[model samples]
Target: MEFFVEQNSVVRKIWGKSDTVLFIFAGASAEFALNKAVDWLYFTGKLPSDPLGRLFSTVSYARKIVFSSKDDANKAIDTMRKIHATVEENRGAVIPDWAYRDVLFMLIHYSIASYELLEKKLSDAEKEEVYNVFYRVGRRMGLKDLPISYTEWLPVRETHLQENLQKSHYTSDLFKQYKKHLGPIRFKVLIESQKLVVPSIVKKLLYFGVFSLLTPVIPMYKISRLIKLDWVLKSILLPSDYKAQINELDVHSD
Candidate 1:
């Protein structure tokens, strides 16, 4: 509870507002509605406005849509329709929920593509194509310009970590949940990121006595990913723009 509060509270303090909320729940819930809630609040008038906030808010709204059921999906679609209408009428956007929904869809699709690759699930040509999409999105999201060759992005022959995973184990449960739901390709991404680390065999052996298992990591990953990366991307927007985008998406009559 404390970790959850701290993690969310930090975003609140960073952005400012108790009215600021994200409705992500675990294992089969009405998360699309939560996405809608984010869409509403963000579109309406209560969240940050910047590349980092846009990325975080986008993922926060997207996470649920990725995990939702058909019924939940329909519910989200209905809610999205209303949100779209509201935002269109508002003339302002920050953390634009529409842009978020787009990015969120790409992330889920990429996770699936990653899974197929990890299990040797895709043929060579298919794999190459899937990887291309990954690079395209990475480029779009401002994750450094995508490489000319998609295959190049895979865990290089060199032993390295996924930048997303190599971090402290602060939000272990959230990270664990992400790993569990991420399936294979996404899991492999985690395996290679800063959010997770491959400890030396000797270290693993030494820790085995105390922990008994490889630490499943993701929450910690989020802890790090949330750090503002605008400086690196040199993203060219102001916080107010993102806040305006979110406000424009707001639709809940409340």
Candidate 2:
């Protein structure tokens, strides 16, 4: 009955709530677009073609790993590796190890960022715990040169931000696809949400302004969550088609 993430773990608190998970992807969507290796994502045609579906699919695997037993979580990780291996086989080139690390780093970064944005600040120990979970995932996936601790990871994460991201044609096209899929209103929300969680480098690279529109709205949104009226707001802010999937993001609450 041992879970991949312990029952009382902060990782569960971060990923269990729908709002935090949404913001995690909202931030990740920006970084994913700006990644130097984004063409690898485009190779499958899935990310650009149905970005929201891709988000949910990725979230599904993440939650499976976070919530299941250790054996099941390891199996899910193996499946993900095999899927990428097949993509590499088809494309006839290996995806760079750094690209894999970038993704793992994104999960670690955004998990802390999104949760702190929605809830209170995490202590140093809690932040280290977050890093440890994903560090294990990275090791399982055979990524090399990952920083051994969250403190060590900070500079490495910064280095990756500097060396591994650029505004390519893929960046613009992916943002366009996001806007197309989310529409004007939701896309604006997504951008603002990304502002609240993404790193300074991401903000600078994307030319985001100093302020987010959501800065003032977050307190009000927190109030709405306390009263159980958050879904009403979510309905208005999110597309109707994904409403069910969005609701399902609140796994630990049940």
Best by TM-score: 2
Residue 107's lDDT in candidate 2: 91
Models 1 onward score TM values of 0.27, 0.98
lDDT of 1: 0.33
* Alpha carbon lDDT at 74, candidate 1: 40
Instruction: State the lDDT of candidate 2 residue by residue for 1-254, as single tens digits.
Output: 87778888999888899999999889989999999999998999999999888877887788889988989999999999999999999999999999999989989999999999999999999999999999989899889998899999999999999999999899999999999999999999999999999999899999999899999999999999999999899989989889898889885755
Q: Which stretches of candidate 1 lie over 4 Å from their true place?
A: 1-120, 155-164, 173-254
Q: Write the per-residue lDDT of candidate 1 for residues 1-254, one digit (tens) a residue.
A: 12211222212221221112211111001122123233443344433223234345544443333234435534554565556566767855434433343333334233333233222244565545444433433443333333455356443311221111222232233345445554555433433331112223212321323331213433332343359432222122123334444443222212
Residue 202 in model 2: lDDT = 92
